[model samples]
Target: MHIQLLGGFRLDCGPGPVHVVPGARRLLALLALRDSPVPRRVAAALLWPDTTERRAGACLRSSLWRLVKPETPLIVVTEDALVLGAEVDVDFRRACAFAAAPGASPEAVTMLKADLLPGWWQPWVEAERDWWHQARLRALEVLSDRFRVSGDRHHAYQAALAAVQTDPLRESAHRTLVELHLADGNPAQAVRQYQSYRTRLRAELGLEPSSHIHELVRPLLR
Candidate 1:
């Protein structure tokens, strides 16, 4: 059983997809992202945040009734908690593990390159999505630096470019790209990237790039 929650919500039972309503999908997604047994009260509260506890609890029960099956158990219910089925796996969890490594294979970047449950603006979902974004950004920065140190300029540039594309305002990402261009004997490209960042920063935030990043491209600017 596989649950995909990185780019979007999907469920694969074995050979085909399982159809579920939007309410059920949200419940399952919340539990899957939590990656642990959520206390019944806590689950109810989060799912129906604006309602009274009693009403939310009732809503939780209705959703659970539609979800729980006798033969195909998708959730394991304990005394006070709701647990994801033991055999179920979440793609976001796997993506996080992949993003945790600095020197991962190039293909693994695909797993790190997705927004968590895109289009969902719930507080919990937004928090997790932001967390994943920052984590992937760190992973990309490290991967770029590692490739740069190893003299793999092509891969280094790719990673740095991806980082900048992922978050255009990230100073470290711009710095990485500048360094990569300089390493590839293109001071002109380095200066171009630095100038682009400087212009963007000034336009968006009324600020300049940090001294650390400015120093990286200062020689070329002169």
Candidate 2:
């Protein structure tokens, strides 16, 4: 299965265009929130809090039925359990697992293509979006630390650049860029990064860069 959790949630069965309904997506998200198999009643309450028990039960049944048809390969649900079907493969879950581990593979760090569901602007998606965003940032932070610890300043610099591209407003990224440049004997580049950050922060927030930011690259300004 070609499962994509990056942008909203999409699951393709092999090369076919199988559709996963909204309820299924909701159910998947709920399941993903838990480490162990969540109880059926709890799942029902979370998704259908506004409805009566009977109606919510019906909706849950209907949603699962649609996903378990012969042609569907997205999920496997037994009497009291639900999970990603054995045939399905999800990159986001895998990437998240790798990112959470202490010694995650560099390949896993490289797989996070973009912020999760960047164009999606639904209130329902916010929680998941925040979770993935934090995970992605942590992965990059770990990668940067690994590079710096290993005496690979170039890779550390590149990781910092990638972090800035992901989140330009982050003063930490600019700090990393400045530190990396100055460490590599490129004080001019460090100054340029600081100037750009100062201008952007002032323009956007109508405020000066933080005192910590100023202190970070003060020597390079000389």
**For each candidate, what TM-score against the reference?**
0.88, 0.75
How much is the lDDT of residue 155 in candidate 2?
69
**lDDT values of the candidates?**
0.84, 0.70
For 37-125, candidate 2 gives per-residue lDDT tens digits of: 66677677777878897887788888887774556545666787666655556666777776677343456546653566556554545
Pairs clashing within candidate 2: none
Q: Name the runs in model 1 displaced over 4 angstroms.
A: 68-72
Error of 2 at 56 (Å): 2.7
lDDT, model 1, position 90: 88
Ten-residue region with minimum lDDT total, candidate 1: 101-110
Q: Model 2, residue 141: what's the lDDT? A: 67
* TM-score computed on alpha carbons, candidate 2: 0.75
Candidate 2 has an lDDT of 0.70
